[model samples]
Target: MLHVTTYYDTLKVTRDAPAIVIQAACRALMQLNHPDNFEGREYEAVKIAEDLREAFDVLIDPNTRAQYDNWLAKQMEQSN
Candidate 1:
């Protein structure tokens, strides 16, 4: 089985996490992966930060989040 990465996983939050929890998770992840914190791996850190930002963008909005949630549910069902 292929393990697909979801926005919830990117933010390190549960699928049913609240908006505030998602927000906090995104902030914490970005801070942890900040380019300034990794001198040698700065490029890797930037890429990770970009992914986190994308996850945050989708999960932060109500309409998009609902759409994503539906899509994620189908993905899970297929994976099973």
Candidate 2:
């Protein structure tokens, strides 16, 4: 089966990870996926980097994170 990546997975952090940890993870991922760091795959790298940035924005905000957490829980419940 193909594994789906969630925002938490994208950042390499746990769902309950604190904002600081999430920020650090985002930075690390951004650096790794930076377009300039890749050659022929620059476009794909840029897209992944942008996604990391977006995940960071949503997960760093308390209100949005809470909402996202709820949605994630619902998804997991449905999958079971």
Give the least accurate 10-residue stretch of model 2, judged by summed lDDT: 1-10
Provide the RMSD of all predictions against the true structure, rounded to 1 decimal: 1.3, 1.6
What TM-score does structure 1 among the candidates reach? 0.89
Summarize candidate 2's per-residue lDDT along 1-80 as a digit string, tens digits: 33678999888899889999998999888888887888899889988988898899999999999999899888888787
Which lDDT tens digits does candidate 1 get at residues 2-80?
A: 9889998999999889999999999998888888899998899989989999999999999999999899889889889
- Give the Cα lDDT of each candidate: 0.92, 0.88
Segments of candidate 1 deviating more than 4 angstroms = none
Question: How many clashes show up in model 2?
Answer: 0
**TM-scores, each model vs. reference:** 0.89, 0.89
